[model samples]
Target: MDGRRNGRKASRRVGPPTNRRRRTGAAAPKDALVEAVRQSRAATTGSRVVELMARRALVVAARQLLRQHTDRCTKCGSTFVTHEPAFVHCHYCGRMHRVANASLLEQELFEIRMGLRLAS
Candidate 1:
């Protein structure tokens, strides 16, 4: 379009410029911080699902383990405990049975006597 707008004239620098140094590939602290934050978030988000599942499974297993006993209905003598709070209802005779938790020592002794240990 014009003599000044030519590629040769456009490539000319005004001066030597303030800094005569060139930035290396490993330069810039701000970029490094940004990359570190991105990587940390990615690592945590990826393993979050595994952490939640493990915590849920632990709580469920603890609940099951705490329910150490089931009563037998007086009328039918069936140990088939059911319902929300585990009110042992006899299917045969239609009766509700009362249950109680044994002492901590007794439970431990019983577990030892029965060779009961963690399944895992």
Candidate 2:
């Protein structure tokens, strides 16, 4: 009787719960856009907005760092070298690589446009 009771308990614990209906409520879908918007707007109209902006800026900087470090040479196993703000040159095969860091490049381009506008 004791062995049978122990075996029953062990089996019950080992497998999924027999009562599947006990889990309530459907899980929410993972939405990156919704989360980003929520985080962006969570703070009221002042320092909170600035802090959120700073956080976003840091995230962008980290992403740029990853891009710079992880870019690999196609011909050899070396990381590509940054030749210009928007270009990298592979040292092994002397291949020029161009990558668009959309936001950063856009900002630089905008600055140049503004300067040209002022000059004109």
Q: Which stretches of candidate 1 lie over 4 Å from their true place?
A: 1-68, 79-83, 101-120
Best by TM-score: 2
Candidate 2 lDDT, tens digit per residue, 19-47? 65666777666796667656774543334
Judged by lDDT against the true structure, how good is candidate 2? 0.55
Model 1 weakest 10-residue run by lDDT: 81-90
What RMSD does each model have against the real structure? 22.2, 13.3
Listed in order, each prediction's TM-score against the native is 0.20, 0.24
| Model 2 stretches astray by more than 4 angstroms | 1-71, 102-120
Question: Residue 116 lDDT in model 1?
Answer: 62
lDDT per residue, candidate 1, 28-108, as tens digits?
Answer: 699898888778966758755343568878886555332433555545567665532323446767764433443555644
**lDDT of all predictions:** 0.55, 0.55
Which residue pairs collide in model 2, if any?
A: none
